[model samples]
Target chain A: NAGVTQTPKFRILKIGQSMTLQCTQDMNHNYMYWYRQDPGMGLKLIYYSVGAGITDKGEVPNGYNVSRSTTEDFPLRLELAAPSQTSVYFCASSSQGGQSPLHFGNGTRLTVT
Target chain B: GQQVMQIPQYQHVQEGEDFTTYCNSSTTLSNIQWYKQRPGGHPVFLIQLVKSGEVKKQKRLTFQFGEAKKNSSLHITATQTTDVGTYFCAGDVTGNQFYFGTGTSLTVIP
Candidate 1:
């Protein structure tokens, strides 16, 4: 059903480059989240949106920003990518916050050089 | 800071052997969810435990939520090659966000 779709499965960015990570869900969920996973580590939240026009910072929100303009789209932007931003970015959505199980995207592996 | 820690950062077990991974949270959680990510894939939701001291089984996997709701465990009864993946426990400490554990990478030797 393509529950959650993410673009650019892999990318390489030069230092200070900016890019956007696109995420969309067809489930019409209200909760959406962005998380990054370093090599051999767990996922860490970057940003989240509870509903349209609402966004919030997560544990690791530096160097990144997010916007939720529509019910189906939550995009994460990297204003000035750094070497430390190299990680696997995952987009997830759930029917509800916390109570519902999350549906994650295939993930985008970003490498900042 | 609500942190979730998992024991045994990595595990290698022979096929047909049992394996278990533990997840402990710094703060009490209202619910804990388990997810598994295969090599080169994203995390996939496995199950969730809400009630205190709750236990649920799915095929060969068993998930248990401690009575205190601050700890959880995932046990695989008879592991196989297909079970090779990283297991992560995500806790909902405030019913608004999920803090994922450090994760336990499991490898099954066939």
Candidate 2:
């Protein structure tokens, strides 16, 4: 089974543009997280969902929004993207919250010019 | 928010040399996990530690958790070329989320 799937493996957007990064997991995990990794840096949490219809802001939530409308899907939206938003976005899912191993998607490489 | 930091942001070691990376957290952690990311790849789970002062080993790699549960370490004995990657430690401050360390980039010199 595809553990986690992310759409738009690569994208280029101009400043002030908006786009959505789609994430879906087949494992029926209760926890899903959105993270971004800058060059030569660690992953920063953007947003997270404990389950369907529940969402929370993370450490670096500015300029981003997330919705968990379905158990299998959690999408991150970039509003008025800036150059600083150019980074690799990863969507991860875990069977449990902060206790189980995380299954991460390949990641979306976004470049904002 | 809890913060996790890793030392020696970058390390270069000769093949077969030992290497270690340390992780420290600003607050006590409920659990800590280690992950490795190869160049141009996503991070992959390595292991997790829940008990204070617990140690686990996987072949040449050994992981340790601090007694206070605020720090952790990963040591590789006779590191191989395959060990070249970025190592990250994620500390769970609460039951809901984890704060990831800055990461240590290891380069193996042949």
Candidate 3:
């Protein structure tokens, strides 16, 4: 089974472009997270959802928004992309709480110029 | 804020040599998780430690969580070229968010 799937493997955006990064999971997990990793740096959490219809901001959620419409889909939206937003974004899902291991997607590489 | 800090941001070791990366946190953690990311690849789950003084092994790799539950380490015995990757430690202080450590990038020279 495809544990986690993220769409638009790669994208290039202008200074003020808006886009959405799609993420879905087939594992029926209740916990999903969106994280971004800059060059040579540790990942920073952007947003996380504990279950459907419940979303919260993480450490770096300034330019991003997320919505958990269904248990299988959690999409991250970039309202106004900036150059600083260029990084590799990963979507992960865990079957339970933090005690469980996360299943990560292949990641979406976004380059904002 | 940076809650967790990892030592030796980058490591270059010859094949067959031993390699170690450390993760230290000022606050107590309920559990710790380890992940490895190859160059140009996403991070992949490796192992997890739950007990205060837990230790787990995988073939040539060993993972240990400190007795205080604030520190953890990943050691690779007889490193190989296939082990070249960036290792990360994520600590769970609460059940909500997962914060990552500084991260250690390992480069094996074969």
TM for every model, in the order presented, reads: 0.99, 0.99, 0.98
Docking class of 2: high
Give per-residue CA lDDT, model 2, range A38-87, as digits (tens): 99999999999999999999999999999999999999999999999999
Q: For residues B1-110, could you state the per-residue lDDT of candidate 2 as single tens digits?
A: 67899998999999999999999999999999999999988889999999999999999999999999999999999988999999999988778887899999999999
Better of 2 and 3 by TM-score: 2
Ranking by lDDT: 1, 2, 3
Q: Which regions of candidate 1 are displaced past 4 Å?
A: none
Predicted candidate 3 versus true structure: per-residue lDDT over A8-50, tens digit per residue = 9999999999999999999999999999999999999999999
**Could you give the CAPRI-style class of model 3?**
high
Candidate 1 clashes between residue pairs 3 or more apart in a chain or in different chains: none
For model 2, give the interface RMSD. Answer: 0.7
Question: Which CAPRI category fits model 1?
Answer: high
Q: Where's the lowest-lDDT run of ten residues in candidate 3 chain A?
A: A95-104
Which ten contiguous residues of candidate 3 chain B have the minimum total lDDT? B93-102
Candidate 1 residue lDDT tens string, B1-110? 88999998999999999999999999999999999999999999999999999999999999999999999999999999999999999999767779999999999999
TM-score of chain B of 3: 0.97
Model 1: how far is B72 from its true place, Å? 0.3
Question: What is candidate 1's DockQ?
Answer: 0.88
